[model samples]
Target chain A: MTQSGYASERETTEGRVFTVTGGDWDTVTGSVDPLSNEKIVVNMGPQHPSTHGVLRLVLELEGETVQEVRPVVGYLHTGIEKNLEYRNWTQGTTFVTRADYLAPLFNEAGYCLAVEKLLGITDDITERANTIRVLFMELNRISSHLVWLATTGMELGAISMMLYGFREREYILDIFEETTGLRMNHAYFRPGGVAQDIPDSAIKKIRDFLVYLPKKLKEYEDMLSGQVIWQERTQGVAILDVTGCLAMGVTGPVLRSAGLAWDLRKTMPYCGYENYEFDVPTATTADVWGRYQVRLAEIRESLKIVEQALDRLRPGPIFISDKKIAWPAQLAVGLDGMGNSLEHVAKIMGQSMESLIHHFKLVTEGFRVPPGQVYVSIEHPRGELGVHAVSDGGTHPYRVHMRDPSFVNLQAIPAMAEGALLADVIAGGASLDPVMGGCDR
Target chain B: MTIEPNESSTGGVPVSADPVGADVNAPAQVPSSPRKGMFGITGTGDVSGFGGLVRRHPEIVGTAKPYGGYFDEVTDALEEAYPGFADAIEKVVVDRGELTLHIKPERVLEVAQIMRDDEALRFELCSSVSGVDYLNSDARRLHVIYHLTSMTYRRRVRLEAAIPAGGSLPSVTSVYPTADWQERETYDMFGVVFTGHPNLTRVLMPDDWEGFPQRKDYPLGGVPVEYKGAEIPPPDQRRVYQ
Candidate 1:
């Protein structure tokens, strides 16, 4: 209510205003303006929701334009490869499956193929098992791509698409959970064959999913394709041509989007992928929009493969006949958890002493693989997933290295993001679909 | 000789104890090295009679000419394309439907350049670059494996180079720019320095981290885990299959 030398008041026609405190603040105003420098550094993640898992991007910004982008990974590193060295050959699937959480089947398939090759038993893998692998891997590809579409759409301001994307993804995950007993990190694949046969319930769920997904995919395309905002955000943003993709070792949909039809399924068939007839989709624009189209098309292609694999699925033993490498326990999830079935347990416990001893020895100390190394690559959702496995004629792995597609494809971020608008960094990264679990494994 | 207790004190590193007396016809024998049982318990732990198992660390012998399938064509093409191939190539190992061309560490760059540029052997894509630690098996224990794919030919070839720990291998980043992060990862994990890489920093591990985590001798350090107040030893401290 009182006016002193520290406070001053001014009256206008409409109102009265007061100014308070020391006005001659030269020290506070002496520093240069932050906007005047024309360059700023922004750290975008490791915690940000849009970064996808724990990827950190350090960007040098020149007023909303990215001058340089340095992607810092390894925050999610769990040393799965190192841990694999301590486990038996069959137990390796558990570790590798967790590497690429989005595409666990791909990781398992690649690792198993490498192990089978090392044991010189590639041809011995049952046709039914291989068919099952193709079936699950194709389903995994669709689920992984759906998450990519959903998250990328959310990150680019289409919130509703994210919900729809996840809804369809949940259907696929339900199929996975019913079959493998876990939704995300299913180590269903084993060295000689799959851990068990696909149950009849899982088949029914998959058939239902096969019908439900195409309609959802059409709905997604109709919703986002003509939206003006989506078009402006994606088209011509973060463009990396075929040459850039090749130089950065970008594969899968990103490389395909850059106009190279180099899908390992087509070029180098594995797990009887050649048996299924599907087209490798490509887009020439080499931008975020192109990646979107390519991934969406890939989902359709995966659905086609899944349908064929379903039809070709014949009734046969899923595990290899070789008793040496085949898992001893007939695994089934009990009320407590996954364990040996009652019949298998009863047989091993009461029937023959030799059978019990054999089962115990095999389960604890697995069959030894002949010493050698092999690299097996499978086309994962993100790119080419390669497993470099070495066995020193032992039950446990000597060394196993996974060349995860997310790890290799993330290297192209700087080439794709630099000199583009800062917001496009998120777009480009989302387009690349870098899963940090796979990248840092 | 008396055995020492609490070997876990050294953070569960292998004791390098003398092997048992099951030394019948083992090629590279020092002693009978039986893997310790669970919780650092030194015993056969092999109830199924695998204790006498002598694992075969088969020395990779290069296959003689006509190296089967497309391998022969790739070799012929490389030999015809690059004049220095004879000197650059150390060994040609064909195993399990895959071809491995072991090259001198110093000549990796030159060999890669030729492998990429040559019309006959155009491995345009270097699919994967990784390092393996063959700790006691080889004198040069650190091996860098490069998996190259020829999209034009639809063929794959493995080029590998073995170098001593801390030895520098010529970086193939010039030949395959994609080898950038892979070389960094190799450097970070196996400590194999890439001589000519543009930015050779740790890509996977933190900058301040010490010791290559993936090396065979490097300990997989972890505190003993306890379940319901009963302590269970860590993996390294537990039984190992040597």
Candidate 2:
């Protein structure tokens, strides 16, 4: 054993010493190296506070730098698409609204649009209904962007911004609660039209919200825009240009932030968005800061849309007159929550047998959509929320697939996170503003 | 056709005066049964007695020249740009103010490439990729639909490719990188394999999860909870109107 490469081990000293000229430094350095050369795998969460709602990022990091990032989602997959198959055409609103909790109206609107398209009743949808949809959707955009601002701000060490963001969001939710009944996941939008007409109280609340949000938005800008920490964290960080955004199908504030005015509301106008007098906001930085600025500007733009929608709102039917497609019982806020209006219920049940039968049949069986497939995309708070609905001439949907913006936009995580500092990963992921429910639906 | 009393009452509900029956689920198969209701549930108890009535699913039919709006322009540009236009495109369907090009499954990638690259076509963005399962109706039941949007022309065209179960289709990731996750999701839901997709894995479903959930045959799995000892069937097992 001792008669190896280094002649012999001489025991002149306290311990045996051997000097070798032709030593294998490669193997020596490779085996006993520090954690710097050795790549470390970090699983950031299916359950962590900062990763934004059940999103798990598998990051291979070399110290502070992320070598590779693989986002492992599906923690919040409730099988909404599969569940939609089991539900009726009207019941689908309830299911779809839950997909993206933040922007539930957009989901409902998209699903309803697809259903209307399938039924060939798109043109039949009332002008008042379209205006209502536009109004609520802009409000939802503001609330969603507020959440984005709050969460991203919190992630990047702006704790006060989160509280401010949520405070403003609560105001919008109050408006939603007044009209749609439930604050979030309101199945207000139906296939034919909306569940009910907007009450005068809700209209007043919305008007107030429109006025209140602009001042708060300005306060948020004044608070966070000039801060050194905020600037350092967001500016020039998580940069994904227009080309990348387009290639990855990223839209909404993220795409707008990249300087491409490809807003679906502007380019592919839906819900009478073309008539609204508002600008599509954009920022050229294509970074976290750009997204923040774009979202804030969009809130201002949305406020303008809300005002226009309010002005455009006339005394007309909120739902289509189609008795076959329409939900017979007028939905109203009950003590227990949203249910059929008491007056309508009394008339249907006590007064007329035909009315009772009609209501029962419509409520239970639901109206059939002729066999056809339609794809309807609406600009959601996150991005382009597309609904691909197919009907097999049944009460229930044959197949309904939602191209959720959160789901599509989450793919850009690796592209944004790789080669960036570990801290920037939080900023980039926050900037995407992914609702895991939507991403995993 | 004897209109039931319920049917007559329902007719009072305002439907469009002129419904283009040709556009919707056109019943190719006329039911032999005279009883009208969903899934053969006929008579008074049922609300909408459309069960026994067979709906004709829309078949892939090419519209004649003036496809109307920008459809004709798009089809013409694609026809001129792509060499094997006739062989690649099975049918050019214009319905609901939307242009649908039913392309051969094997030739989908080529068509997508042409749709994206060709200067005239200029379909810069592939908006969505989804799968639909037409169980028992068509031989090629699974269809992969690509919604292509052209920023230059402000036009949207739907490109569809149909294939049987366990069939392979080329990935259009090369042409539209956005298809990366869309294809995976489609694969996860419908089990449609995209041959060239970099990572075609289950997106929404758990890695170890069993079967594609969105397929018609796949049941919406859930524990049936009894209410006051009354056994209410799960949604999939319930007596559906259709």
Candidate 3:
């Protein structure tokens, strides 16, 4: 459909004149045969901006309504899971953080927690490290939600919100850069603790974000929350009942919107989430609007948590005391914009021979986790991000399986979009927020 | 009192609990011995001595076995719940701290259902379903793993079922409901059939795809091309790409 303000016309030889509407109505109509029993196959992605990231949906259409939607993933699969088996335990964190690009901290935390549990040192993680983890995770949650808002807005035709959302997200990335030395795929959360301590400059930036984001959130609400077009496009579109959501393993805002407060953070506390004070946002409508409202409310809740975490911040050791489990030194950005801290280099070269040897051995071979397996799950921005890591009492993992929420949640598309208008597919898919990198990893 | 040799073998040592005879399997006592270094412990003498120790304490013997990666507290709980659970379980492994119980392929769904419905063993949330191909293992190479969580107890368990290549196993979709996509994914990747699954169509991969890619035996096919006048080999041909 070209947005040219005119309906293209066509004529049939059966003494009837029919208008061929939009671009290539013949191809569209030819793809479907009204007389035949075969369903029309419509390919929706791989290049579509609304499919999140390189996701392809093959929708079986019956006229304007969807009959079935089969999502085609793995176009972004980088074999991160298979590759983890080849690397040492410590090196594995760098790979996992790249799985869920939007919420890298959560991925790292879940992976590291599982490894720590295997090592039987879950209780040994320093309080400072845990608190920093909570702070960064919440920050990651906010940043991820902002991307969701931005992309969802763009998909729903609220173009300006896209720019506004990215502008706000840039501030969060700036904080990440200052602290972890990388914006995306920071790999900041190590097994026993964080890669580096938070800098005062980063803390000030986060405080600034805490003040700046709430006002911007309200501005977004003012702009689109009550707008007629936004309401029409989102409200009552792609309604997913609680049964459908749970059946499809769709958790997070979408499931929360379906009137089920099934957040892993509240249901199963990890990393001292039980100590935090924040409300789990829910909506009863179970529609696109419900998901939108739930996510917006969640942003507010996350902001509150971040503010509390910032206030609770105290100076202490950021890494675990167990030298075997912890990274050798805090990483800093190199001249080439890669991680290369002075402490790391000094330990590698100028330190005592034994110290240098230990550092080299630990870095190269990594510590062996006791032979066991652990499944560590966290409430990611999209949904439940679980890491099923299995160690064979070796330096490397035996099997590292990531239960990426985006991948599982994307299964709800056909259930939600079937029998709905084709236009609703965009709304439904955007509401699911399936990041392809995470899904295909 | 002197203990019977048969009773000792069965780990049925009797202890006084409140003056009543309680059958508590007392940890087998060992004589004070000289410590052995790491390398020394792997010698023939140490191996035989270790084997003798196992012969004495059979209950704690299997606990130290070198499981590939399937390890977790759930395994211990399952063993406690069903005495001789290791016998019932087809395979018990400790991988990375995640315990995997490879149950009989047929009993997978039933075991999963029981795990969910039993109040004491409530695995309320089916967190993830995945598949792995152990081509170098047994003939039944396809392994389906289900990660279950009990929100109430704050514990997690993994249920694994393996099938021979082209064989089918029971589906747990009815038990957890979340196993729908996971089962499909297993089927898609490993060609493991999940009987009685509601929707067992291919997910991620196209419906008409020919081979299961995740299996170790399956060649990693790729598009070969020339990059800057240099020939690029397929994935299966390359050991490590620069």
Candidate 4:
């Protein structure tokens, strides 16, 4: 047998290059020490399933320990903000709703608030409309957090947790579907008000939901919170202190998990959040488990707000009074889906000629916004969903920029994953609850 | 007229053109918009279509002293905290109940540092960093905006800096690490260079892409699509209501 381990060994700029034939394969592996493999670099996704979305991670590993981790995003970038430039201000809601696909209502709410502020109609939004906004926003928050729990649970090996979480989320989606025509990307929100008023059937469904959710939540807590595997996988993993989170602009459950109660709803009240009575949940651990606890508590808090908002709901106008700004079509559900009501069609066809003219101009060109820029932010289920809207006093927006929480919170991935085990990278990133649709948009 | 929410039996949601007329007790006057009948094609010899409506650049003017609410407190603290406050700032505009401090592009980093560490004005979290291109309106076409939140005081302030096309500014990632990806996005979209960004590369676009997608001068690229017996032009080519 030959004593030589390799056919050839040389050093290049890439460091070591070795050539081995079948005859020398056994000899080379036998001669090399397993621990002396030096550095290992792995590129783990842009397509991998466990990444939660179209997220890529570059990891420098020493055995199982991750030395450096870099999260590479932008695979899902659809140029949403760029596309918004060509559309009217009201149509911009459709584009932004697709940014954070899960929290579609939050995206619309933030964008609408900014546009309304720019139009100087923030105070004029009807009381009923504000209540409806709060109601739907909280519902959207629960659905989004449920998806987070489902996806993160799936990634962390709690396969049944995914099923249970999504089962509950589907129930909420049904309620949303009953109100808006589509379950997702409704674009229901407008600068002046919602696309349509909520019907009593959807209200009844929401009442049923309010009763059905508490039991399911309790069931989930019993199934996973005390489980040993769940604890081992989540607790004391990915510890980023309050300073790290704040510096990285990490808000939402991640920031609350780190022990600072800096919820925008509580700290900087908007959309009548000050009127709602609820507590901001916090866990001092600042780890994956802390995030999990915080999210669960938040779901309960949201349920409280939802119940309150529902009770406060009264019969009144759901849109602003201004015909020039309000949506021309009074939407109604037909066999085909939500569309212009027959009554509206009759009025324009038969009644006052001025109403018809106003409808044409409003629907076609949209109302012009006063030329200026304003920034309005609301607390998204993920974090702060901020809209920076600029207008040149034209129907179309000059430029609209969204500061999506997923995009900002993802910056903390490296700070959490650098010194942890390679598996912990998945756990830490899931804790931040990043939605790539929002991050890349 | 006000209390009949059960007027429509279909799903119990009243679906009537009645929304405008249903609320009898409340005073919501749906103003009759200025009537622009047909023949109201603007920018022509026609005398209709609200021709009196003039489009002018919304001027940028500084707010006078005692800028109301917390804005005054913020300006005073920044003045006391930073020694070069006046030299570094271009203007302080308070509009729509939001305070905007327009700092010189060259002095953004220094201003940001003072903004973060100032005990009285401790803006610990940077909510966002974004770019807006004011093309054909301002000489410095690219404008960068930063939203800072003082968690302690529950206050928010916006910092803006203007730079020319293809211009450079210091990165604020050192003070607020969250700006790393956001700065990259601004650069990728608007071509505003952050000189000291650790890894300044195309974030939302391919590295070899030719033009910035969000710039005002860049064309909205699209391909023509053919339908049943007709062709629809791209969005950029379509005639829109100006």
Best by DockQ: 4
Of the candidates shown, which would achieve the greatest TM-score relative to the real structure?
1
True contacts kept of 4: 0.84
DockQ, in order, for the candidates? 0.54, 0.48, 0.22, 0.57
Per-candidate TM-scores read 0.89, 0.88, 0.78, 0.88
By summed lDDT, which 10 consecutive residues of candidate 1 chain A come out lowest?
A: A21-30
lDDT (tens digit, per residue) of candidate 1 on A313-414: 999988998998899889986554457888999999999888898898888878988888899998999988999998877778888989999999998999
Q: Rank the candidate models, highest DockQ first.
A: 4, 1, 2, 3
- Alpha-carbon RMSD, each predicted model: 6.2, 9.7, 13.7, 12.4
**Angstrom error at residue A143, model 1:** 0.7
Candidate 1: residue pairs that collide: B19-B32, B19-B33, B20-B32
lDDT of 4 by residue, A278-305 (tens): 9999999999999999999999999999
**Which portions of model 3 show Cα errors greater than 4 Å?**
A1-39, B1-102, B116-124, B132-142, B150-155, B164-166, B174-177, B197-202, B205-242
Worst 10 residues of 3 chain B by lDDT: B13-22
Model 2, A102-218: lDDT tens digits are 999999999999999988888899999999999999899889999999998889898999999999899999988888789998999999899878889999988888778778878
Give the clashing pairs for model 4. none
TM-score, structure 1 vs. true: 0.89
i-RMS of candidate 1: 1.3
Model 1 segments more than 4 A misplaced: A1-36, B1-53, B223-233, B240-242
Model 3 Cα lDDT, one tens digit per residue, A17-71: 5454546675877787565554689998888989988899999887778888887
True-structure lDDT of candidate 2: 0.83
Q: What is the C-alpha lDDT of each candidate?
A: 0.84, 0.83, 0.75, 0.84
Our tally of clashes for model 2 stands at 9
- Model 2, docking class: acceptable
Instruction: Score residue B123 of candidate 3 by CA lDDT.
Output: 76
